[model samples]
Target: MTADHAPVRGEATGGLFSGTHAPATVSFAAVMFLTGFAALAVVPTLPSAAQDLDGVSLYPLVAGCFVAASLLGGVLGGHWADRAGAHRPLAAGMVLAVVTLLVSAASTSIWHLAAGRFLDGLAGGMVAVSVNAAIGQAYPDRLRPRVLALMSACWVVPSLVGPPLAGLVTEWWSWRAVFFGLAGITVLPAVAVAVVLRGPSWGVVPAPSGEGAPRPALVVATAVSLGAALGQYGVSGWDLRHLLCTAGALVLVTAFASRLLPPGTWRAERGLPATVLLRGLGSGVFFTLEAYVPLLLITERDAPPVVIGLAFTGAAVAWAGSSWVQGRLLERSPRHRLVAAGAIVQAAAVVLAIAGTLPATPAYTAASAMVVAAVGMGMFAPSLTVLSLTHSPPGRQGHASSAMQTTQNLGQIAVLGFSSALFNVFLGGGAADAVGYGAAFGLLLAPCVLAALLAARARSV
Candidate 1:
């Protein structure tokens, strides 16, 4: 089909695994699974890697590098997909992923490991945007949600096994083994992804002229990525240098980041703009909670590592299950309404988390917050993705997907920074630990509320 005349729904008959869709579907899922496994597995090994390299003081920077690099990756991948096709970027990202794994495996210094992580994040961002763009180009509107849900499902087994497996490897062998092993296992899958993308079934839709122009978007994305890294590092401490870093980050983002998003995104203009805004808000709320909740359980309640790990597992499972429900049972529901409902559910989860900060509440109450928030995300996140694709002008799905990824990263950085500030302020003011925790959790409600209020604007007029 021509760009302007692209079909709203795909012409494929039957389910994802049936007939012509099977190869692309299976290949994409395998890519996601490997990606998910590497992500989950690598995280648990960071502390050991940092300590062994004698970079304990710079741990936050090491961890934050991946997120920073992903912003650039997203923009690059999106533009590449728009100009060429999703397949090329997707295949390139897979290859880059393997290369990054090898880089990390061979790291001899803390900075080397950080560089590897940044490269991996870049690869991840490319892969993520390419997959979403592929879905938009290849699948019809009716099938998008299910495809997204299946992608979510691909992460489940990885979530269940990755960390523990990495932990065992780290404990039994060395942290490097995790990287080497991930690289070894993913090589074939990466090749498979490349081979699959070579097939003609993936609908290689390139954006029309003037629609997917790159120019300043890539530059803006780079600045925003740097700002995010600075902001994350800034919030790791409350020193004067960190404070100045934080201020600088805000300035950078405020100045250039909007150029990368839809016009009036900050104002939550109806349709695509609001959809992008909601992605940020919803993501901010969930990531903020995800970061702080485990810290609360560990420090305040003295919860064991096992308990924290289980909470993460539960959250992953809940996210997958909820995504399945939205894609399967509620497939006919309006996307905007589902988004609003999800926001409301997320608000409730935040409240539960706040309540858990009290001395009288059991520790599990706080831990359950992660799962609850994930449940909300399962519904909210995919609905937004579907809506974004639906509302995107024909041939511009890559641009839309890029905007969503950009804002999602910004949301995490902004929300986490604000909540961290609140937590630090309360603690510095001599408040009890519970009060500080309460303040941080309470700050998350604003985004949840804003997202709920603006959810309707995401609907296509």
Candidate 2:
């Protein structure tokens, strides 16, 4: 439906925060900012935390556990939102986030840290899915792009300041303080969301799916989590047992993943399913490649940590800028074309990143590539999200939004896992670390190119 036809109050105002949604908007943005701040703040500390805990070998687990656990949270949260509005799950998710932060704050071992991260992921995943579903339900089509763009923009201040402040905190005091600080900061937003989201303006009629998680989806969510955990473990080890575990994980993931996504998602079935596929592909390639950016810059180029942090800050700004541009253009431009353009830019950035691996390449080359790639992701992500909401029927917005989250997470895990395994294989074969990094980056090219090819299929019918 066009702006004139949408069933919402803010079409004539052109202001995302106008009318009934202002309170909810503030609450959502606050939550996003807190999470964004905490994420950037804590990421740099994890390696140190792992080292101090003597769990350096489990570093990948610390990262993967969150994403793995999020799958369950996403599916379960979606089901809950569909069954009983978004208020309860969202409130519960926020509370869980606070608890998880405390858990991480007090951790004395790597296992404890991993457990904290896993629970954090669960809470975070639920909060993310619930918020997206809320947005889908709350805003009309005319406002969705702008609203989602605003969501992206919420990362701006956090991205700019979080890392440096976190560095100071880690230097002056303890890493545990960061977690405690974030937990404390989160309480305000949690309370505000619970209060503001209870009004009639935020009410959503429950979907027809009964009042609980679907048994099959819950089962699939469990399989996906297990598969992800096993996959991460499998790639980290080298024995025959590891190989067997890898094979089993793949089998389970392959068998059950189809149930979690829309039918024909694998084939890029036209319309909503294809949009979903593109979201996964774009996210998968970029994030998988992104994980190595700091490592390569610090290890290969000997770039200073400050420069590395600034590079990420620059990328965040670019992402928000691109999202704002897309929001402005949504009325005049077709989403598929925008997605295609973004995908092509992302692919080029990936190639540039690989070139930056050369010893003679400029120190800023990798940073530039990362920044440009962020622009592409920023442009496409909200567009696809808007499409997901517009395409689904009345009651299934939760399902569609949940599927998007699931696919994005799965994409990250699958691509990162495969590239990690390849990186290890190259290292085992005596390739230089630089060469392994290059090969790993090269592995991402396939999905990037495919995403560009399939972008047109994401067009709404």
Candidate 3:
């Protein structure tokens, strides 16, 4: 069967693997790596940026601006690509990202850093959509799950390491070095794309129908994501006002998203509705638990940072490996079993997390809980992604992908925000010094419950 997007076989040109990567695969990975670079690398160095700016006060603005801009970029990039073409948008965005990295490295003031981060994030958003859409078009159906899983793994590996390396550069050399280093790392991906995927086979974007109203929903999702992100940087300067802002942000986000999705989806009707819900719930529970477990180990259980880092490493690697394995293993499984088992495993991990907390030893408890959470998350994410894409129509892949990501962004905000408030209510001022360390860990159940509910809906779907 001929593909609507690719009229010619790219095999005639430089293949993704010329030796290793097929042209499409290589190009897709290149884009995914860029997305990972921004998501993972720049975040940890914000403190150094704050220090370099010579005032701690500007830190919140620095982080928020980057996130806000990225949100906007995601909307623009997706919409523009749909109107223009993926190849040009991705190519131009990469160049822009590279230039911004240089600007980030050379920044002399907070404003400069903010500008650079914002630009960098903008490029990141473009990369996320184009690369993902490319993968959807390029890979065979049987291989798509693995390809997406690989993309997820690339994100996980770099995201885990980018922060620490950013911190190290800031500590030993300068935060600027992290930016410069990222700039240098980008060359490979950019070069690969230019060399390997430069043929006529890849299609530009199709024009939007009518006014493209679905895009507004993505913007709202970004606001929701921004609200959740704001909570993490609160140590720099966030409070009740920020929290309240997030609440309002989420309402708008939800309302907007409701419009973009297929009718009755927000309510999780059969088929695609349930798929979107699964995407949201899978991510929501995983991160809600993730955000707090380390703190529990360090403060409540009194484990050291090194041990905590190891616990995280375990979760990350496990997640990555599971994503890879599922790519190979689940090709034959019914979407129903694959999706349902992934959900059940992830929920079961939350139960395991509860059990881990029951143990008194911080080291043992943290390790056990993290392993469970990581494995569960690993199983859930890629599988859910596959099911979501599986049911999407060819032309609607962009809309569906955006909807999935949009749901995830909202999930992070709504589930995480609600969980934080729950944590404060359950374990407050005692956690003022403690940061709600242990009680925060308990919020894993919310997402698990949500996921289970969605999984049931998925079965019927």
lDDT of 1 at 273: 89
Number of the top-ranking candidate, with lDDT as the measure: 1
- The number of clashing residue pairs in model 1 is 1
lDDT of each: 0.89, 0.82, 0.64
Candidate 3: tens digits of C-alpha lDDT, residues 1-461: 35542423222233335443466675676668666766677777888777878857767667655644554565666555555546666777788888889998898888888788878867776666666556555554656676777777776667678667777878899878888888888877777775555665556434345524245544565554454345434423236766566555555555555654556676788776787777777777777667666656666566777776777667777888777777776656665566666666766666655555554544556556666666766667666666665665454455566556656655655666676666666554454533344455556566666666666565523
Which has the better TM-score: candidate 1, or candidate 3?
A: 1
Per-residue C-alpha lDDT of model 1 across residues 1-461, encoded as one tens digit per residue: 66444332376566788766778789899999999999889988999999999999989999988987887788888777777778899999999999999999999999999999999999999999999988888777778999999999999999999999999999899999999999999999889988877865455465566665444555688888889888989999988999999988999999989888888899999988899999999999998998999999988998889889999999999999999999999999999999999999999999999998988888899999999999999999999999999888656777788889999999999999899999999999999989999999999999999998899899866
Instruction: Give the Cα-based TM-score of candidate 1 against the true structure.
Output: 0.96
Clashing pairs in 1: 10-140
Count of backbone collisions in candidate 2: 0
Worst 10 residues of 1 by lDDT: 1-10
TM-score of predicted model 2?
0.93
TM-score of each: 0.96, 0.93, 0.83
